[model samples]
Target chain A: MSAIAAGVTGNNPALNIGIFAVFVAITLVVVFRASRNTKTAADYYAAGRAFTGPQNGIAISGDYLSAASFLGIAGAIALNGYDGFLYSIGFLVAWLVALLLVAELLRNTGKYTMGDVLAFRMRQRPVRAAAATSTLVVSFFYLLAQMAGAGGLVALLLGITNKTGQAVVIAAVGLIMIVYVLVGGMKGTTWVQIIKAALLITGALAMTIWVLAKFGFNLSSLLGGAVDAGGKTGEALLSPGKQYGATGTSKLDFLSLGLALVLGTAGLPHILMRFYTVPTAKEARRSVVWAIWLIGIFYLFTLVLGYGAGAIVGPEAIRAAPGKANSAAPLLAQALGGPVLLGLIAAVAFATILAVVAGLTITASASFAHDIYANIIKKDKLADKNAEVRVARITAVVIGIVAIVGGIVANGQNVAFLVALAFAVAASANLPTILYSLFWKRFNTSGALWSTYGGLVASIVLIVFSPAVSGKPATASTPSMIQGVDFHWFPLENPGIVSIPLAFFLGWLGTVLSKERRADKYAEMEVRALTGAGAEKATPH
Target chain B: MSTSHDPGTRPDPDEPDWAEVHGSAEFVELRRRLRRFVFPMTAVFLVWYLVYVLLADYAHGFMATKLVGDINVGLVLGLLQFVSTFVITSLYVRYADRKLDPLATSIRERVEGGAAK
Candidate 1:
């Protein structure tokens, strides 16, 4: 075990870089080819609505399953056992919310951005502005977390222990992401996601099979091995409370995190935007079903991979590694197939980060250009049709730079909370507004504005005041993001329990308080959303 | 696409009668069918999930009860969440295909095809 642990830490940098370079080269060619048809705003923003349901579903899985899902959850399970599995369940179950409630309806009504759906019935300008604000905020925080994860991941895989090397790697990732969005637009980015999702799932599946084979294809034996390897806390690892059951407040915190995880995905801008890439509402529904299956299967693989790492590589070795829990999968790869498998899995992890960040950049830039600039600033009267696409490209570049800088500044910090915070903001700010706009006839501009801004502010303020940001001290297993600071008033690390209900209430209150009733517009939106009566047509180039 | 609608006045001749369609028995039935499936399903799953979470958080001994060799209630319940999700998705897909899609398709064609004329 010690020998294998040393071998994992001493991974061959050249082989890892070589595998990753080949992946980048092939994806770049694919992006360039896809860019040839990028002509219209619809093409740039929604991939000309050309992809099939299955294709878009794979891409959605790619976008939805980030390095956090691939690396972080695997690490969490490896260390904390059943507690880590909770995240996987939360994430997978969240897709049910997306499928049952929002997926088809959003596709039937909106064109490119969430703003289009929200502004369909209400005052267009204020609603679009507010939607754009939340979209950018959610995308930016998500981007920061992904970018920072890239640095830490490369540090683990390539043995780049120096800060300068990690920063350069982050900048390079940001540059590649910007190029993917700027050149290929939505079409290019979607293809990258599809490819990456395929690779990630295949890699995980291979490791799962390999690990199971080692234990004679018996899950019980594998579980027993994990329990034996866990030592004194072996029984605790098989159950819950290892991570989230220490105290009453900690139990409440678990509930809060569960709420955020389950409700947040349906409101995510990038995930919402993927629904537009399919032509029909049925196709959108199909894509979501597809995503649920692919995502569900991949998460199952994480279960095996996590425990496989625990049983084979042992927990103590995992903790001693540089990236700690996050290094479990790669170390397992080394233990199973030496440097060659580690290199391949490492490339897949890198591709996961790249695909996710590229997806986010496109969503954020599209929101800015479409909702904020084209609709609000230009008032839907753009003389040049291609100007929106151009603006989106420029916005992508600007966002890439911002993400690179943020990643550098936040590198090596505990940015896991940022992703959770992103989910909180999405659930609180975006979901209620979307639900109201789609379902409620009396939903107006005041309601949209109130829910969006209210939810955004409430979630962010609560996160800032929560223990995640300041009060918590570094423990033996986990380190606080900010040390020696103890000013937190909020008890729970996640604010979803408070913020989501508040946003829903505020939306209702704002509508009743205002005299802005547009029953005719509501009728139009309802007919369109339910029956697909004036939904955007597929303009495949 | 146009947002400027005078509430009391008739819509443009070229535009489909959205208000009329919205009030039609077909549209009303379609919406009812969707709500009937989704709303109840949503409530069921959310409650089911909350129970599982509460068990994991509070019912430590019960969750830790060993079912087999190293298999426990907590792990089984966690995997059941996955099963329930897949089941709900397949059920919704089947329901929509059989009951909802045909009705929605007819209404959409009526509105869009009428607008074209």
Candidate 2:
């Protein structure tokens, strides 16, 4: 195992860095070109709503499929087999909630941010403030996870094992991401995502076909190979209970994770913001359909890639590697097509991180500039029309710096929970308020505030007290993030099951307790959301 | 067609009467049509997903039962989720095209046309 680990780490770092540098150079040129059209607040924030459905769909997939989906899920399945595929199912299924409940409606009602829709029928300042707060919190947590993952990935792929070296890599990634957002804004960022998505899907498809060919294009043979390579625990790989089925509490935890993954996508600030990049509600719907196909197809590839890694790379060697489960796909690439293939895949992984972080940074900065600064602070009375875009650029730089610092601090910790926390927060904090504001005529400012703040607070509190934070005894293979601490009181790892219902209840309670009802506002919002009447039109450049 | 359209009776010259539109039979029917499809469909998919999760949790033996060579109940069920998602997406798109878009377009045209007048 040690020898195999050493062999995997002996990958050509120079080749990997060379590939990554070329990708960065190309994307920067694209960003510079895309920035030419970004003039207004609309252009900076939403690419002037010029993207066709298919183009936006590919970009959405790029934004949606983070390093976690590509590397994390593939690694997970490679290690855990059937249990790992569960994450893919949860992720793919979550898009349906986005498509059915939110996509077209949000595209019609919102201008730049989720705050736009929430404040449409409510008191603008307070509601916009609440929406911005949640959006920032969600985006920050997600950014931290991606940034931290970047550090670990470079260590594994480029063999940059030194702490300062990994930190430098993380900072460089952050700097590049900042450049992407500051220059291209939404238009540039969307192009980056589109390029990344195309590369990621194509690369994964190539590897998937390669893996299938190894076993005569038979899935059963692939599964059998995985089972065979798994040794003593071989048969367990083909079934559930390997990862989440240890005890009753673990089983319940799986359910909580399921709830979060399925309900969370619709509320994700970054994902929700992507809808504004398209021309119309119909285009938004079309983009979602495209995202579903792209994302769904990518996940199917992960299923094969995971089992293939298990079969070819073997679990023992994968476990011994630096990133453990996260090392699966890269190691599989090495085994199948040697260092060049590994380098290309590593570049794709880097592109995944850069694209996703750019998306989050833009969403967070847009929320702050559009919601907090323009609406809350300046009272939507900016002296200059371009001030919002200027503020957004500055906010992007600040967010990039914060993410860099946070990533360095969280570099070696168990950061998986952070991404899950983001999902939980979105589902609990944002989703309920969005549903109520869009559908319930009686939903008032009080309900939106209560649900957004309440859900945000509840999920964070639950996470702080959950076993994921503490109380779980570290195994020989994995260490807890905070060792020597057992302060956890909440039994579950995911806060979605408890927090989601609590948010819905609080939203209803908050509305009933307040006597504020705006029938006319609700009517206007309903008409606009459903029929696209009086919605923001795509500006002709 | 409506008294609100008469300049003498209107309160705001530019803003359409949204409450009136909301109360119109077409808007009500449109909302109903949307709710009728999405609400039940949402319920169905969520229930289907929860059942799959619950089964995976408690019914380990059942899920592990081999359906074919190296293929088990769990893998098939998981793949079915992908299938179900694709099916639901296609069905919703078709339904929206057939029942929702035409109605929404007419409502939008009438409201915007009224506002212009």
Q: Compare the candidates by DockQ and give the number of the best one.
A: 1
Chain B vs. true chain B: TM-score for each candidate? 0.90, 0.88
TM-score of 1: 0.98
Task: Give the clashing residue pairs of candidate 2, or none.
Answer: none
lDDT of 2 at A430: 94
- Regions more than 4 Å wrong, model 2: A1-4, A476-478, B1-12
Q: Give the Cα error of residue A345 in candidate 1, in Å.
A: 0.4
Q: What local lDDT does model 1 show for residue B101?
A: 97
Q: Which ten contiguous residues of candidate 1 chain A have the minimum total lDDT? A: A471-480
**What's model 2's lDDT at B98?**
91
Q: In model 1, how large is the Cα lDDT of residue A483?
A: 78
Clashing pairs in 1: none
- TM-scores of chain A, one for each prediction: 0.99, 0.99
True contacts kept of each: 0.83, 0.77
Give candidate 2's TM-score: 0.97
